[model samples]
Target chain A: MKTTIHLKLYAGLQKYASASDDNHPIETGDSVREVLNRLGVPPDKPLLVFINGNRSKATSLLQGEELVKVFPPMRGG
Target chain B: MNSFIGKMLNVDLTSGKIETVSIPTEWAEKYTGQKGLGTRILMEDLDPKTDPLSPQNKIVMTSSIMAGTIVSCSAKLAIATKSPQTGTITDGSIGGHAGAELKYAGYDAICISGKAEELSYLYLDPDKAEIRSAAELKGVGTFETEIRIKEMAGDPQVKVLANGPAGENQVLFSCISTERYRQLGRGGIGAVMGSKNLKAVAIRGWLDVHVPDMKECLKVAKELHAADKIDDAEYEIYTDGTPILVDFSQESGLLPTDNFQEGTFEGFEKINSASMKEVRAAKKACFSCAIACGNYLKGSKSDVEGPEYETIALCGSSIRNDSRDRIIEINSICDDVGLDTISAGAVIAYMMEMTEKGLHDFGIRFGETEKAVEMVRKIAFKEGVGAEGAMGTKKLADKYGGAEFAMHVKGMEIPGYDPRGSWAMGLAYVSAPRGGCHMSAYPIEAEAWGDLDPYTYEGKADLVVGLQNSQFAKFSMGVCDFWPVASDNLAKLYSVTYGGKWTAEEVDIIGERIFNLQRIFNIMAGFDGGDDKLPGRFHQENLKSGPPKDISMPEEAFMKSMQEYYRLRGWDDKGKPTLEKLKALGVEDRFVQQYETYLATS
Candidate 1:
């Protein structure tokens, strides 16, 4: 059976995301890094990943988190 | 064969002496232009011990080498002066047509000295410059000052930089307004203009700015535009402007809420990008800019060019006020009155906390929108409670007794980011040459919004130093901060316009040299490692909610990181750059000797 987790992509990563990008289906043991690769983001791109509003590593395994946010490098005030 | 324009203007307001001076060939190559060039000139013009608001103080304004070229985002100017607020060597970069106009008017920079005998404005054109009486423009807001100066010039296209009632009153954080919407908006540079009895600068120029080759310049500019479009895919500034930071700051627990007593705001959703989009009236850009990051919003009560992230965070969550309309109204008032929103919002928030804690009665509670709006005008006009508020946080804290939670580094109030969540940002704030300026070295891009660990002290020293050096170099080029142009592209840009082969490493070294120059100036002005510090709040207080909850930057770890930062910059334990390091960086022998003398005597 597949588990679902909420996903939000920001900045230029929005181009890779669709409206259905939210509530994405994933395998129970999938890593955050793996999910991003599936979504077509460049493998080497640095990202800020947060799971349930807490800073999470890209290699952290997912367990049907309530929400996840991913963003490319951005700088401004 | 370069974009130097070959000359600068020296205006002595007291004696009414307007002289055209040739730019030195050696200084041009050594310092480049803009912030770097301006600092080099400023170092030689006035003494470090000169009173910031006295007639002895001097103001240096520089046009970037890229200004008036086909370079994108090149409409930036640098203003350097000793800050009346912080008593540090402060420089601010402003975006507008004025810098480009300076280039077209056949000048690379302007050095204004001495006080005007009466209230006056400087009018400049290709032929001549005159100091004209501005007694009729007295007590006017910045918005009207710009319009009236243009009308007086009989040229609607005349670029103007004007100060308002706040500047005339010499409010410590008053800003100089340009293009009606943009400002050189930190460290009380406007107060310096006010102290000189200078009201505005009205400039009109039609002379052609030179380049090595016009055809190659255009071709290179086209390529750069294309590259910016492709490389800046992650920059949502054009669409969402700075309001995009509202959501990111909220999620990362970096937003300054309730005078930084907390990191999260319950009403944050009300002022984020999505909400801003609902009222977005128009988008604007600086001269020669393609990205056009300026967003104009129209709310029911007011319309303004911005309440950008800093304004929204500092005026919105920092004050515990969530009304977008109210924020817009406050932003409009501050812009017109020529007050810096960052300092104004931070001061108001400080007073609110003081009031809530029963230390003082400022008559405004947290989240009082109407009272905050009233205070903007009061601070500008210096009325009632505005008198003390206009003096800024450090002075108020000194008088009213709440230094621990004053929320400033040096005397300048901290901008939006709460450093507790992003640990390197704490270092950035404490170590910034200009005091509490996020633009000096923004670590938030790496820590809060990128891949770096936000809660650790490790590796922060290197990150902050690198960012500061790069930022100083970029500002020297007069490029907008929004464009994430690589060092390779910067080298390409220099080669195209100036007919010189520039390596990426050379550009990097220029950045390091400029940073060290400013540090030398600050040290000469009597700042030491002891002056580089965060307020007591960051070390002692913890946020009550969100990801950064119960987290305060550990004082010992932070001090260690700061020392490491100094070491990385080749400064001594007291944060003074050694003479050997200066000689290695090719800093002038005069500055090194001046610094040496200052160290021994002080």
Candidate 2:
């Protein structure tokens, strides 16, 4: 069965895709790494991934209906 | 003498004496400059147990060896004093032209002691230093005080550091405002100034700072700027300033909502970077800074330099008030009245919780935006309940019986980061020489924002120690925290400015030494392992939302981490630095022997 996730990109990472793509199709067992690969994130670029507002490893499997967020490595304050 | 002016100004208000003293070469070599040098000066000038508000207390203002140079972000001014709020050795870094101007004025530092006979301001130019009456400018807001001082000096370029009504009232959390925007923002430095009847200081100078190699300095500065242009973190800072943290904090369950009852704010979208960008008026920067991180905003009813991330977190999410415009207005009032926004928000939020719980009736409720603004004003003017509120969260909680939820580590209020989500941040806050300061060591960068697991206590102690050491050294060197220079680069900068062959290892040692020096001063002031603790609420209560939902800082784990942190720093279980560690850091023999005897007897 197919599933979809809400994807958000921030801090100059939106150039790769729209800032918020409310419904992005994914497989039931697709990993964050797979999603990033499909989204055209450069393989060597470092990113902070979050699934449902929790810090997630890129290789962690994602469930459908998750709010997946990606950000460029950023720090201030 | 390459970058330092090699002259120090000693101002004794009681005697009306102003003397130019040569800075000791030994002190310069040992402490470097800025916070480190200022800390050393304070150590020698005032007894640690002296009342912070009394005339015996001294305020040491020092510039780094790099100030007044073409170095990027090298214009920070360090102000060190015993904090009236925390009674700890506290030093704040003020950014603007003040430090650079002082260097240009042929002085590396100013040590101000003794109470003035009356209200006064200091005026310093190339060859003149005078204590002038500020009785006419009494009770003026910091913004107007700056304007009036400039008029008095007849130079628009004159940099002014002034305190407002909050300061004049001796508010425990009052801040010293500079350039009418930046601040010596924490630990009640302004209160000390007010206690001394010092309302403001105006400085102007045009002399060229001597550099060992002007050519090399320019090349290094250009390279640093070029690198900053392409860096993603710097770009985010340059573009979004600090409100970008709102997005990350909200996402990571670390936005500090409702007095840290919860870590995430549902109304975060109303005050996040996107919301702030809507009202963006302009961007500003400190002198010689490449990263222009200051966001000047024009809200619907108010205009201000920022409601920076800390202000937004404390005044917006933490208070449950999400109106961006009101936050900006609150920021303006705090800046104008010379109040520390972090502590002000902490006070208001604590009172809100107190009132809600029926512990005490502060007449303020959660998300009462208008009431919150009024409280800020009242706190500044010492009106109504704000008179008590100006005493800060710790004392309020003490009297009102809410010590469990006071949100202060020492007597000083906690900063924006809620520690339950990032355990190491708790360690950093508790172990900070000053109280609950985020700038002491930002472990959240590694945890909430980076790759480290935010939930675990493992390895946090080492991370906190490393960051603290590096940050302390950088502050001493007068480098801006935002620059993120590596040890090698920092060593190179030092070598160029101080005319020496400095190594990265040596630079790291300087950081360690500065950290130890502050710790020693605090220990001497009577702070110990007992004082290195978090508010009970963090341990007893769980955040109710986001990823950190149902999570509390485990008391056992936290204590373990604290002990580990002390061990890593070569401090005893009681959190006093060991004699061997002090000696290794090249601390003077007197301090080493004093600690040696204390440790032996204890």
Candidate 3:
């Protein structure tokens, strides 16, 4: 079974986002890092991942999460 | 002078005496250039608390040693003075040919002192430098000034850094617009120019900068430029310029609306990136910039170089002017008249909100662009309501009854970032040496797009402090922040350019010293715990509606970060640098004496 969650990828990861039109469908108990891997983001590139507008570690569970946002390294003022 | 030029053109406007002075190599080793070196000059020379408009107040225009190098984004000019707005050590960067041109003219800096007996403009070349009367050029718009001056001087290639009617009128928030489109657009640097009775600064370079190691410089430049092209897949900046941030700000719950009453604008799509591209005439680049994030949009209102994110958010969203065309028109008018768009939008929004609240009615309403548009002209000429508007939001709030929502820090109006949505950003706003500045420490990306928790209480200080130090270091080295120049590479490039051994660790240390000195300049000017604070709105109010709702600046979480930032900065509890910290950073004893004296006097 799969649970759906809102997902947004920005900066460098913006182009890799192909999870339907918007919210991503992921395994119910997928870890944050697992979701990133499933999305095909480069493993070595620095990223800031969020679960439901909150900073989430790679080990965090997504079972209860409803939103995810991933971002790539960006520098500007 | 070596490759650094190590010489400055010191022009005393009153005495009409221009002299060449040699800068000590020791100064370069310590402060780097621009941000650090410029601030060190101010701290050592002027009373940090000197009234900004006074003749006694000095302003320095310094370029980085790499400014004229083949390196991309190396053409930025740093201008520093006691600000009429922030009343602290205030500086901003102007991009385009000015810095590069000035550097090529055999001087690293053009430091202007003493007010002129008559309005004047400076012209410099490799052989001759003169202060010429600008009487006929008074009240001219910045763009026309550049064009007309070039015609008058018969040199189209000469770069002109001029203020608009606003600067000539001495509007407190007026900014210096250079390269026609780019600006040193914060803390009323233009007002300082006006106070000096100087109208415009024009320059042409006939000499080439001596690159000590061209091969190494080219290798690094090629790699950096290549990396920049692919740095971000979105490539929004390269494609759409900063207008790309409009939709991102709206979507991410960070768009400032109704003078920051809300975090989202309803008219986001109308002013987003795609719309800007439609009107974009051509892409623009700074002097030697490869990424060329600047834009040139052809609008029915007037062809403009911007309506960048700040203009869209401040004038369009916050002030309720939803039409992209209208925003572009206002942007053109502001540029033409020489107003800082951020402060102008902020001031107009404050007036609109005040009139709505019946606290004060300036015959303005939100979403009504006509009065505001008309006021843009008046503000530059100091005409009528524009006179009040020229004072910017802080003073307007002080007179009217809306200090609560004035949206400033340390008397400088804050930018487009909604602090409640990003805690670290809020900390950056309050603790910015120049007040409410986002650039020195842009950890907002961490919360907005990256790893830091936007709403969390912990590690914010660490993030802001780290970014601040790194950024100051970057400014010192005169590297453009937008370029894909890594710290390691920056140190390497600097080492090669200056023939000095600079390790990445040294970069961090030098950056810290520069950062600490800027803070010490503020502290010397009598800024205490009181100046390091957010506007009344952020502290007491939450966004009424947005994706990031119920978010007010959590005082405890944010304050903890501020304290941590102070600690990391090696400052005492009162936000003053400790003696030990000063010693470590090599802040001179004379600076300490001045700091203590001003601290006592103020």
Can you list the residue pairs that collide in candidate 3?
Answer: A48-B450
Fnat by candidate, in order: 0.62, 0.51, 0.30
Candidate 2, position B236, lDDT:
68
Off by over 4 Å in 1: A2-4, A11-47, A57-65, B228-234
Give the alpha-carbon lDDT of every model. 0.87, 0.87, 0.79
Instruction: Give the per-residue lDDT digits (tens) of candidate 2, residues B1-602.
Output: 35866788999998989999888888878888998899988887577779999998998999989998878888888899999999999999888889998988878999999999989999988779999999998899999999999998888999899989888899999998997779785889889999999999888888878788889877876776675553344256776878988988888788888898988888998998889988898889898887778899998888998878999999999999989999999999999999999999999999999999999999999999999999999998889998989999998877888998899989989888888888999999998899989987988888887778889999999999998888888889999887878777888888788777888888888889988988888887777899999999999999888778899999998999989999999999989898889998899998777656655655
Q: What is the interface RMSD of each candidate, in Å?
A: 2.0, 2.3, 4.0
Give lDDT: candidate 3, residue B133. Answer: 85
TM-score for each candidate, following the candidate numbering: 0.95, 0.96, 0.91
By summed lDDT, the worst window of 10 consecutive residues in model 3 chain B runs over: B227-236
Q: Which DockQ-derived CAPRI band holds candidate 2? A: medium
Model 3 lDDT vs. the true structure?
0.79
DockQ of candidate 1 compared with the true complex? 0.53
Fnat for model 1 comes to 0.62
| Winning candidate number (DockQ) | 1
CAPRI grade, predicted model 1: medium
What local lDDT score does residue B28 receive in model 2, on the 0 to 100 scale? 79
